[model samples]
Target: MTQAVAADLPIWAALPVALLLLLGAGLALTGTLGLLRLGSFYERVHAPTLGTTLGIGCVLIASMLYFSVLQTRPVLHEVLIAVFMTVTTPVTLMLLARAALYRDRREGNDQVPPPPPPPRGGQEEGPDGTTEEMAAMDRAELAERR
Candidate 1:
């Protein structure tokens, strides 16, 4: 943001603009820190979204407010850019993450789903897809009929 644009802003507006800018910077910094410090792969995937969403949003909104008051016009281009970014960032992030997962799976990395647990004593499945308990009951009824 240009200092010239905000030179004429009143203290009330200036305070908010400065505060918002600082907040935006702080969010972005936190996002970067999270990406570096977090241990899990999935946790890292979502770290930058904080910056992409609220950090950039706050900065853009502050710019919009500043320029609108300074230029005495609507200062709408920033708003449009902000809207576009807010909507697209998450979608693109998701698509990228999904693509990475697909690639990893296709390449047969160590990301396979865990094996199904062995059936327990009373819950063993029969070959025909019935449980052992049910098959045993069926056999008892057949003997009675005979």
Candidate 2:
């Protein structure tokens, strides 16, 4: 069982904790604002990383401090979650961006960069003996044709 203390906390200790919590809230708000204000998909993708990384980091520090002070035991679970999120979020974002690019390219949309040219010297000869370069077909159209 834990007992609550009514005594005033020291300025040094209380100040840092309060500052950390305020910083975390500020970072979260900034990240959310970035998400709303940024233009384009690629630009928007970078906004949430600020919250997931820095905002959560500040909050985690505050959690560790509060828990350690209250229970007299180090609370480290937030560290694990922070590490996992940092490692996985970038990978997931990369995959999603790649998938979006692929989909857009398949639709012949001009928003994405053009794919690399096909290999040379594999041209098939037509009935008229003229050789033609093989062009990549739209993925969605190919799927529909199939």
Which numbered prediction scores highest in lDDT against the true structure?
1
Q: Say which candidate scores most in TM-score.
A: 2
User: Cα lDDT for residue 65, model 2?
Assistant: 76
Model 2: how far is 54 from its true place, Å? 0.8
Which lDDT tens digits does candidate 2 get at residues 58-136?
9888877766665668888888988998899889999999998889899999978998654344444355652232233
lDDT per residue as tens, model 1, 33-142: 99999986667888988988899999998998898888888888887888899788889888987777777777877864533344445545557765666777666556
Model 2 CA lDDT for position 56: 86
For the record, the alpha-carbon RMSD of candidate 1 to the native fold, in angstroms, is 11.5
Find the number of clashing residue pairs for candidate 2.
0
What is the clash count of model 1? 0
